[model samples]
Target: MLFQIEDIITKMQDDKTGGVPIRTVKSFLSKIPSVVTGTDIVQWLMKNLSIEDPVEAIHLGSLIAAQGYIFPISDHVLTMKDDGTFYRFQAPYFWPSNCWEPENTDYAIYLCKRTMQNKARLELADYEAENLARLQRAFARKWEFIFMQAEAQVKIDRKKDKTERKILDSQERAFWDVHRPVPGCVNTTEMDIRKCRRLKNPQRVKKSVYGVTEESQSQSPVHIPSQPIRKTTKEDIRKQITFLNAQIDRHCLKMSKVAESLIAYTEQYVEYDPLITPAEPSNPWISDDVTLWDTEMSKEPSQQRVKRWGFSFDEVLKDQVGRDQFLRFLESEFSSENLRFWLAVQDLKKQPLQDVAKRVEEIWQEFLAPGAPSAINLDSHSYEITSQNVKDGGRYTFEDAQEHIYKLMKSDSYARFLRSNAYQDLLLAKKKRGPHAYTHTSCLRACVKKAQSQVNQQDDKCLELHLRKGDQGEYQPCVCLGIQGWSKSSKGKSLAGKRLTGLMQSS
Candidate 1:
């Protein structure tokens, strides 16, 4: 019955229906990756690799942009930029191959030639009959040239290897000639060969042949862990903003101090009409000798001082334009509205939550900073704000405001604070289990154990308390302010005993 149906199916099938021609699965697989344009290649590469390391991927990708399909990362993977133009800002890696027309793909042809020319020859994958014939001939011509050039290089490498192999005891250099797959180069893809041949075809094997042997059983796969943390959420944004605020404080203080120092240095070098006095709020001392005061002012400072830091401002009044240039710069960088918001809540050790909320809203009205109550980020979903502004002792609670800010951050795709390296690192590291996508739990566990064994160089006192473990799984290590007390007391033998007991209980 099966034979009869098969016979009818084959005979009656239209070109488009009933049954497809019997071609190997490899044929379909080969067609899957589409050619991509240089721009599309870059965009796809950016998406595929870690966004945090976009620039790193671009370094390798640019080669494909320069020469389409000339260099393959591996035999299974091909890269090409559309129109075969090397472009600035194009990421050449991980592009779909079909979007590009694969005509003139000299890079791939060059590689084929280089392979055939070398003593270490490789098989070329056959394609269409006519094209394949042309490619094979082209490949043979290049291959001959590559092998001739490589003969000289091979002799040099072998001589060098013979001298160094005694010290290194590595068989790698002796086994294969590792060269870039460029025309006229001896090249090999040993790592890729291992990868391509790593697994057996399960369909051909009727039973668990791997389990039958002790050697096979011993070769249990030990997975390498990728970064565990993959996605970021509102909680992650809050953590990011908390870190940003700390950075803002540090940056602002440093900026203000530098601004003042620069102003003092500038007034001495550039004549400021004697009106821009370095000394302000001074009771001018009357020297016993008027000549002494005159002499002190006349002689320039003992050393040449370079005042390149920035301008200075003693005070900034919105109405006073000239004196407040420095303040204006600061205001431009960190808006006046943000200043108002900070001023509203900064001084008091405690403030009414409602009042704080109102002040933040007022600031939001003046400026469009991320995570503000009235913040209208282009990326954010619009939500109505209450009419009442945040006041010093207003009705909304601090926790409520914090949650609102967090929600605002989550809704906006382009929120700067969330995308900052520090936050994204933390977020992605959490998603991938560690820093890379392939990171697994065991690698992380090993890292935790290793970190626990290491000494904390921060203190000369107790070491045990200073021992920090990466979160039992993938959370990043951060020194908590609360660790001081525990770290301070870890020197005692009693602490070691407690640690042992805790470990036992945990186990």
Candidate 2:
């Protein structure tokens, strides 16, 4: 496709009389999907080996425009005679003339045919032939008109007048012969074509007065050749099959060489040896050291409990199963209304202002009102204020209700939640079977076994806790929040032991 366009452009620029008309070039380009503009044609040409010099490229571009292959049009302006205002307007088309005929279309078609013969592959040859056929058809449609135009141009060239050369002699004669002429005055006809200071198409005598010939008026019309359609034969089909088979064989040989090279390349660079290591490989089950839970184990029980539940708010929101279990626990205690209201208020806050009022009314009717379907325990005064607020609800009208619900859950429902069996079971299950737990439990077993073997090296001042065997036959270590001064006093040791025992039993 690219070579075909370059061929057309080369033929066009090589024309001595500028180049083909703009519409003829456009019509040729319309057959190909790739060529769009004169610049596209030039840039494609510049990449070719033949168009190496910058001067040739510059010359080709100049010919494309100067030869009427591309014509530029400007905006038309209108002005008000009364005022100084002017208006610029655009027309649908800017084409001032219709000259679609090309002077050397036969040479362009010959270039395309020569390009097809240069290609080695049958498919490419057929493609170029089809493109040439299309161009031929385009020419055939306007052949009669093009022939007439060429004939007209030929006649015009043949009848070139010497009026400009005779201007001085005609003017002198008219000056001496015209009636009532001022000195050196010449009639309009006496002036040459260059200096004709007369109205355009001035009145003239009939053709008989000038002795014009009847043969020129009765000249024969041009005859255009008819395009023929060729039918396919069996020999042509067999020839195409032979070409395709040869192409396939050539492609297969190239692919075989490529595959052999790839195999040799891989064998040269790739390592295929077995993996060998020095130590008993560290357990793959052990995890990286980042933990969401607070791992600073020495804090007081009350403080630890606060951190766990505070962090659990995000956990519950993130973990769908945990949230569902929490909601179920709230349902068991008949306080699910608090969670429901909180969730609805969260959704309401995200809604548009127009939607918030409707959502506020729904929440009040469904959960906040006295004897409502899932009524929450609100005081009578709070209930009345909330109902009135819902009636006059703006975007933030639900704020007070959401806050009241949040406080109720954190103080009453959330406190009970921590003590619920569902909450304790979640912690136990996560500590035992979770991915992090699998690694954590493995680490603890290793640490405990190592501690037992090096009992003599164990610091006596440190609080020592007992080790217990888990269901998987791995010894789990009792992790103590390293409390200072506890192992020094008997009372402190007793209290620490009790707290450590409770923590182990709870987990």
Candidate 3:
């Protein structure tokens, strides 16, 4: 039909025999018994080319208008409107916004130039759109083939080892049988195209013009010319089951080959060797069999503070209980002397001038002395400097010695302590306690207490009370001596208590 139209257009352009007039061209088109209606074009576009839906219809209409196609005055042709609802027409024939034709233009050359330019733009857009759609369809078919291959492999997996369901169920077999590629179609393996070998390109599969595979074309049951459609007999059912079984076998073979090839490729090309450094020898003193201590410190443990604290000397000083826990862990590693030396140095730092000399001497003997029973490992220079500092009792006494011990613990003992079973158990226990475990609603209680405790100082006989709100939101009263300098006094407490009591009672 396009060739026929182009042939007519070419004859109209010829000048040697005098070009065919517009009216003669119109007469020639009209003489054709089967004039292409909008419905026929739309149906061909949607059903044959698979371009359906309202949006596609609008796109086709816009392309036609831009390409300057003249729509004959008919019910079908008139319905084709631009997305903006404008009625378009051929050159020199104007249709205004109201969908009614105005006057024809006398300036035909100007109209011809405008229409040609619009056609050129629209042709480029149309070509790009067609290519893009074809590419999308190609990609869709490619993934479809991959998915089918994967599904076949899944069927093979189900039948492997005889332990994980040795046989496919009836429904599963039926599903795989339907998707199994026929002999001619099975020419393309996933690796073939993936390796950029165009052995069986998916583009050929997606394009209808290339023709469908033999199985798709021949799947329908044949009809005898002389007989009405024969009802399925026992023989036919047996044949179908046999065909399905054969298909299943073919699929299994295909997938098994693919799996074996993949395994072979992986074995041949993939290497698991990695560069690794030799591990350091384990310390003789740090035995894994050493027992852990369950010692509790004097201070109540603050789980929050422990979590927030860093692995530093200042953090250990701030949380005595966590520090104690860390020390116990280090004891299990046979490295507790590091912490002991650090703590001794810390204590010596604040010791009075009179006590500093004796305390420093004791610390040196215990942890810094050469051949000392509980001596901590340190560099020769550090050991000598520490010994000199202890004897001199200088400014920031034991400061350098403390830093040396701090680093020793931080590098070795502190790191080991964090990974120890004791520290892990502590972390587990804290996690079990959760955020609300240590929580108290002190603000509400303090508010009520302040409101009630504002009695005058002159009233010595007045009862001092401690109030607590139970879980039921009811206040319980108990007698207790008031602490000195309670901020809320008699005047404010009395006023606040009365207002709060009224509000609470009303609520």
CA RMSD of all predictions: 33.6, 34.3, 30.9
Candidate 3 Cα deviation (angstroms), residue 497: 40
Ranking of candidates on lDDT, top first: 2, 3, 1
**Candidate with the larger TM-score of 2 and 3:** 3
Q: Among these predicted structures, which one has the highest TM-score?
A: 3
lDDT, candidate 2, 154-187, per-residue tens? 3443465443212222222122122112234332
Cα displacement (angstroms), candidate 3, residue 152, comes to 99
Task: Please report, as a residue range, the 10-residue window in candidate 2 with the lowest summed lDDT.
Answer: 73-82
Quote the lDDT for 360 in model 2. 78
lDDT of 3: 0.44
- Which ranges in model 2 have alpha carbons more than 4 Å from their true place? 1-307, 310-322, 434-507
Across 176-218, the per-residue lDDT of candidate 1 in tens digits comes to: 1121223343333223546636743332211121112222111
- TM-score computed on alpha carbons, candidate 3: 0.28
**Cα TM-score per model:** 0.14, 0.28, 0.28
Once fitted onto the true fold, the runs of candidate 1 whose alpha carbons sit more than 4 angstroms away are 1-282, 285-323, 327-361, 364-507
Error of 2 at 78 (Å): 45
> lDDT per residue, candidate 3, 205-249, as tens digits?
211111223232223222111111356688777867776666666
Better candidate by lDDT, 1 or 2:
2
